[model samples]
Target: MTNTNIQILQFGTGNFLRAFFGSMVQDLNENGNNLNICIIQSTSSNSLQQLAAQDYKYNLLVAGFKDGQKIEQIREITCVKDGIRLPDEEEKFLNFAASSQLKWIISNVTEAGMVMKEEGPFEKFAESFAGRLTQWLYKRFQTIPQSETVVLPCELLPDNGKLLRNFILAHSINWNLSSEFLLWIEEKVLFLNSLVDRIVPGFPSHLDLKLKESDPFLVQAEPYALWAIEGPESVCSHLPFLSSDSEVILAGDISGFALRKVRILNASHTAMTGHGLLLGIQTVGEWINSSDREKFLLDIIDNEIIPTINLDRDELKKYANDVLDRFRNPFVSHKLSDISLNSIAKLKSRLLPIFMDYKVLIGYYPPNLSLCLISMLLFYLRTPEKIRDEQEIKLWFKNVSKSQSEIDVLKTALATWLDLEWNSSFENAFNKVRQ
Candidate 1:
C-alpha cells in the first residue's frame, strides 16, 4: 500500500487519538480510501527529536470484552506521514496550514487547551491552543482564498468547535485581517461540535506479555464506540467516510446527546472515582469489583442524576447501563486519576447539569450532588499547593466566609456554586462535609 495525499492532519498523537481517530484512518485506508495522516506533536520541545527520528511509527494494542467473550486486536499504525514538532520549526507548521489536501482537523488537547488567550495570532511562543489555531486559519485563508476547513475538535468541552471558531474570529479582529476574510471565516468554514465516546486507556502492561508471546504486537479496544456530530444536515452529506447506522449521529442539536454523555457516562465516572479512591481502588475494574462502588454510582445516576435529564428516560438508562458494563471490562485498565484531570472543569460539565436539572425538577436541593460540590471546593483549595496559583485559590474562596464564627463557609461555597440559596445550615451540611 502507498500513502496518498494528506487528507487528515491530526494534531494530538496521544493514546486517545491513536485508538480513536488513528484507528479510523487506518481502517479506512485498509478499505482503499488512500487517506494519509500527518501528526503534529503539540509539545515536543524535549522529545520532538526522538519522535521525529522514529518517523512517526508505533504499535497499538487494544483489548476489551464483547458479548461475554475476550477480544484483542493488534496492529501497527503507519499512517503518520510526517511529524512536525511545533517548538523546533514554526515555518513548517505554518506551511501545513495552507495545504489544499488537508480536509479534516481533529484534536484532543484536553479542556483547558480550548481557552482563548489574549495574544495576537502570530505570537512566537504558542501560548494557547486557540491562538495557534487562529494563526493557522489566517494562513489557510491567505493561501487558499475561497476554501473552508472542516474542523472537528474531540475535546471534552461542550460546543468546543463553536468556542474555537469564536476565538479564531476574535483573533482576526486582533490581527486586523480584512472584513472580506472575516466574512469568509463566517460563511465558509464548518465548525461542528462533537461528542466522542471511547474507552482508550493506552497500552496495557500485563497484556503486553501475552501479546508478545502470540504475535509480538497488538492494538485493541472495547467493542463500543460512538461519534455524535452536531451540525447542519449537509455535514454528513459531504463526508461519505463514516459508518452507516448507530455509530455516527447527525442531529438537529447535539446538546441532548452531550447531556446524556456527561450526566450518565462522565458523571458516573467521577462518582465512582471519588468512592474508589477512598476505597484504595486504582483501576475501573477494581472499582467495579467493589460491591458498593458500582451500585452507588448507578444509584446516583438513576435516583439522582438521570431523572433530572431531559432525554427519554428508558433510552437513557439503557445506554447508561451499556456504558457501565464497558467500564467494568476486566481487560481494559481505565485508571481513576486519568478521569480526574482538571476535575473542576470536568465536574462543571459532567455533574452540574444534573444538579441544575434536579433543582428545576424536584424544586429542592440535591444533597449528594451538593456533597460533590463541596468535594470540588476542597479539591480546588488543595490544588494551589501544587499548582502555585494563589489567585485562582482566592477566586474560588471569594464566596466563603473567612471568620470561624461563620463556620459554615464550605456550605455557603457549595450553595453559591449550585446557584441555590438552599439553607446552607441544613443538618446534612455536616454529613456532606464528612463525605
Candidate 2:
C-alpha cells in the first residue's frame, strides 16, 4: 500500500514521468519505503481529469525482452495519491507543496516545458510550465525556507537541471521576487542534471476502446529503464530506493552516461526512423525485427557512432544490445509518424554531432551515416501522408520537384539542412545509393 504522505511533488502527468519516475515510486512504496506522490498536470491541455477518475491508480504494463527471453509485468501504481490540474487545483497544489515531507520535484513536461520567455503576473500564474514551476517554488520557499528540495528533470535536453534552474532564476528576476526567496532557491533547491531512458507509449487509443473498465489509465512501456542523476552526496543519502534497483545510476558526473545513451540509443532511432519510413516500416519494432534494417543500423552504430564516443566499448555494445531488445518488443507500437515530429531538429542534435565528429576524426564520412542522411532527404522529398517538420524545411523539400536529380537535390538540401560545407564524400556515397 502507498503512503498517504506526499513526499514527491511531480510537475507533469505525462507517460514518461508516470512510467519512469512514478513507477519507480511505486517500487519504493511496495518495498515499504513509504513515500507517495502528488502529481500536478503541467498544462491545462493534459487529460488529468481522466487520471483523477481512476482514484489516482493506474496500471503500468511492462513488456520487452531480457537475456533473449520475453517478459511481461503489470504494476498497479498507488504512489500517485493525487492527480492535480491547474486553476482548479491551485490551492491544493500550494497546500501539498508546502508539506515538509515533499523533498523531490520530478518533472517530464518535455524539453520545451523548460522555457519561459516571460512570467506574466503573480496573481495569474504564468501559463508556461516554467512559470508554473517558479510559482510553486516560491510558494514552497515561503512555507519552508531551509528545506532542501531536489528537482529531477527527466526531459531529454542536455544540462536539463541547470538550464531549468536558470529559467527559474530568470523568472524570479522578471517577477521582481524578494531576495530572501531568491536566496532560498539558489541555496536550498537542488537541480540535478539527469538522463532518463524508457519507452512509455501511453494509453494506445486502439487498445483503449477494448480495455476492461477496471483499468482506464493503462500505460505501456519497455522493461528497460534508467534514471541517471548527477548531484551531491546528499542526493544518494536521501533516495534510498536507488540501491534496491539496478535501474538508477547516481553519480557526480553523469555526462558520459548521457552521451552514450542519448547518442547510441536515441540517435539510432533518429537516423534509422526516416529511412524506415522510406522502407515502408511503420514502427521501431518493424525496423529492428527486419534482419536487413537491423544489420544496417548495427553497422552504422559500430562503424560510425561508437568510434567517436568516449565511453567504454563493451558498455556501449551492451547498451546498444539492450536498445535493440527494447525496439524489438512487439507490444509497443511506436509509430514513425510520432517519431517524425521535430525530426529535423532531432537529427541535428543526435546524428549531426556524430557526422561532424567522424568526419573530423577519420578524415572521411561513414557511408552508412551518409546513406541515412540521404534517406532523410528522400523522406522529405516524398512527403508521406504524415506531415512533420518545420514549414521552412517542408517548403525547401517542396521546391525540389521529382524532375530534379535526387542525388543533386540530396547534396544541395543536406548541406543546407546540416549548415555544413557540401562534402563530396556524402554526395558520392548518396549517389551510389541512388543508383
Candidate 3:
C-alpha cells in the first residue's frame, strides 16, 4: 500500500497494539472507514519482516469467559499496510510522517519509553523514541503545516499524551527548531491522554496443535477491551473508531477510568506478583485458582483500594469483580514475572497513592497494603538477582545485609525507599504475616 493510504502511524510493533488497536482499525476498515496503518518499530526486531512475510496479515485470537460462557473468536487483521523500523528505514519513516492522510499517531512504547533524552542533529535519526518522533513531527510540520494531527499515547503512565507533547516540545527547543514549527505544533497538533485496558499474553503456544495455520505474528488476548481517550467529542469525527460499537470511550476526563483500572486491575497484579511467585504460581490464572491467594487479592482491593478511591463504591466493586474475572481467564497465561518488570515503579504508581490515602483516612496504613509492600520487599530481599528493576532499586536490596533481621530490614526499606511511616498496627500485621 502507498504511504498516502496509511492514515495511522503507530509507534511500537508489539503484540498488545496488534491485538487491540490493529483489531479496532481492522473493524473500522470493514465498516467503511477505509483507514490503514503503518507500524513503526523502534527496537531491533524481526517483527516487520514477520508481518511482511504474512502480507501484513495476522490472526488475533480473542479467547476468554464472557457472560458466563466461553467465547473464542478469531479475526485476520489487514489494517496494517506496511511497517518501517526506525534509524534503518529513516527516510521511509519520515515520509509516512509527512503523509497527507496521516491523522493519528498512536504509541505504546512502555512506561520507560516515555523518557526524554539529550540528543542532537535533527537531520539524523535520534536514539530515543521521543527524539525520533520530534524529527518525524518536524518533517510533518515542514511538509504539511496546515494539516492537523492527533497523538494518542497508549502508555500506562498517567497523562501520557501531555508528557509526550512536553517531551517533543523539549526536544524541539533543545534542537533549536524554528518558532513557526513550534507554533504549528501547539496550534494544530492534539496530544491526547488515553488509557487502554486489555490483557494480551501474546502467542497462544498452548493451542499450537489446534491452530489452523502457522502464523508467527499471531497474538492472543482476553475478550475484554477498553480504550478511554481524554478528548473533545469532535475527536470521534477524526477517529471514527470511537463511534463504532467497539469499547473505545471518548471522555472529557479519563482520570476516573484510569484510576479505577490502575487501582483495581494493575494494583492487584503488582500486589500479587511477588507473593504469587513466592508460592510457585506461574500465571494469573494459577493465582486466581488458589483460594487463599484469591482471598488475599480481594482483601487488598475491596478493603484497601476501593475505600481510597472517591468514585462510587458499587462501581468500584463491580470493576474489581470484573478484573478478577479477567484474571480467571484460563486461556491467557499472564506471567507474574512479566508483571514484575520495574516492580518498584509499578508499586509507586499503582499502590503508593492508595497506601498514603488509606493512612490519612484511617489514621494508619492499611494492613493488607502494608503486607503487600512487605511481601514485595521480602521478595526483593530473597531474589535480588531475579528481580528486574532499575539498578538503584536492585542495589538498595543488594545492600541490605543478611545479618539484619527481616523486620528491621523491611522497616528501614519502607522508611527510606517508599517514605512510608512506621506504625504499631503495621508492625503487628507484619509480625503476624511472618508467623
TM-scores for candidates 1 onward, in order: 0.84, 0.82, 0.88
Using lDDT, give the best candidate's number: 3
Which 10-residue span in candidate 1 carries the lowest summed lDDT?
A: 381-390
Please, what are the lDDT tens digits per residue for candidate 3 over residues 139-189?
A: 889888888998999988889999999999999999999999899999999
So what's the TM-score on candidate 3?
Answer: 0.88
Give a tens-digit lDDT track for model 1, residues 1-435.
113367776777666776777777777677777777777777644444554565665566666766777776667777777766665656777787677777778888776567777873355645577777777777788888676678889887789888888888887788777898788888778888888888877657546355444432234467567788887777775554475322767777888888788778878787666545544467888878877756666777788887887779999989888888898887788877666666555666677667667868987556666555555455544333322122444576553445643336645654655444545423464465565
lDDT of 3 at 72: 88
- How does each model score on lDDT? 0.68, 0.77, 0.84
Global Cα RMSD, each model: 4.5, 4.3, 3.1
Model 3 alpha-carbon miss at residue 357, Å: 1.8
Candidate 1 TM-score, true structure as reference: 0.84
- The most accurate candidate by TM-score is 3
Residue 424 Cα positional deviation in candidate 1, in Å, after optimal superposition: 3.9
Instruction: At residue 414, give the lDDT of candidate 1.
Output: 49
Q: What total of clashing residue pairs does each candidate reach?
A: 11, 0, 0
